[model samples]
Target: MTRVAVVQSCTGIDPAANADALTAALGRAADGGAAIAFTPEMTGLLDRDRARAAACIVGEDEDRVLATAREVAARHGLWVQIGSLALRAEDGARSVNRGFLIDGAGAIRARYDKLHLFDVDLPGGESWRESSSYLAGERAVVAETPAGRLGMTICYDLRFPDLYRALSDAGATILAVPAAFTVPTGEAHWHVLLRARAIEAGAWVIAAAQSGRHADGRTTYGRSLVVDPWGEVVLDMGEGEGVGFAEIDAARIDEVRARVPALRHRRPIPRVEIAA
Candidate 1:
């Protein structure tokens, strides 16, 4: 059994505080015998103001959060997957929502930049244009780990099943979606979307999420979860700052795929036109 842990918590403008909270969470996970741990999106900072984000930017080589997380992972001898950090982009005008995977020895294994942007108008008069402050990533990433191949993605990417399918086809048996999904969307679509992805790909889904309200007054849906290939939610923590853990049998992945085989039966979707 591969024991995995997820953090369901809040974030703020203070990067140091966030790191401290994460370290404590990691300790809890380690005590529970988790071999792998993941945190929520914007694990470092959560300022909605674009200028503040730019001002707080740290280069990939010298990022404080990354450095601290590496040390923590090394100390615990566990695989650590940070949800997302605001790293300087190529143009230096904005940052990329990047997720970093660190091996048990604390070496950086892989990184994935978030591909989708969250641009929406909420029912409560909240408007977010994440693209304004982030550059969309063009590539999908899947990395090999001791447990299995992990497909990495950020918040908004959860809405796109195509990306998840591509990762599944590329031999990904586990998918990680680190998100700070807004309250409205999270309450309505979070579980459905996560379970659907797990069922469709016949892979385990581990989603770490931001819960409660942030310093910028942005509310996030906080039910971080781990779902089995059969769409069974192994663990779920609704609305709080806490750690959730589950032991996943990697061998069960093959059993589910062999039993259902939905991935092999997918027919190519055809385009259609309608008269105006």
Candidate 2:
């Protein structure tokens, strides 16, 4: 069994402050004997203002949050997953929501950019046009890690099951879905969706999330979860910010799949024509 830590924290407009919070959280997770630590989305900055966020965004090499995380990971001898960092885009007009998997030696093992942007107009005047200021990623990422074959995804990608299926097909045993979800949607669909993903893929799902109101008045639903292969929620950090840990047993995947065999039972969809 691999002990993994999920960090639920409130991020604000300041990158330095966010980095500090994450560093402390990493230390706590290490103290708890966790081998891998996962942080929430937008771990660097959470400002809504496009200009201010853009100004605060820096290249991955120059990002204070990433640098701090690397240092902390090295110090603790821990594998750190920075859920998603807002980095300055090469085009200079937008930013990239990027997730990094750092090894115990503080070297980046893999990176995944968020593919599906959260572009929606919600009720109560809540609107987000993420595509306007964030470029969508074109590829999915699955990395080999000490815990298991890890599939990396971010906030909005949870809505897409095909991505998870693709990752599962690529030999992923653990799926990391670090998010900054809105309260309404999170309240209604978060647990259900995460559990469904775990059952369908027959893989462990680790979701570290952002919670509470941010500096820009936007609130996030906190309930970072670790779902087992049988769709059981092993851990849930309810409605607050902190670290949650769970043990992931690789044998659970084999046990669940041996019973259900759903993945092997999958067949290609057949085309049907409509007759008028």
* Stretches > 4 Å off in candidate 1: 267-276
Weakest ten-residue segment in model 1 by summed lDDT: 49-58
After superposing all C-alphas onto the true structure, candidate 1 shows an RMSD in angstroms of 1.6
The digit string of per-residue lDDT tens for model 2 on 1-276 reads 999999999999998898889889999999999999999999989989987787889898899999999999999999999999999877776789999999999999999999999999988789999998889998999998878999999988999999999999999999999999999899899999999999999999999999998898899999999999999999999988899899999999999999999999988768988989
Task: Give the local distance difference test score of model 2.
Answer: 0.93
Structural RMSD, model 2: 1.0
Worst 10 residues of 2 by lDDT: 86-95
User: Per-prediction TM-score, please?
Assistant: 0.95, 0.98
RMSD of each: 1.6, 1.0
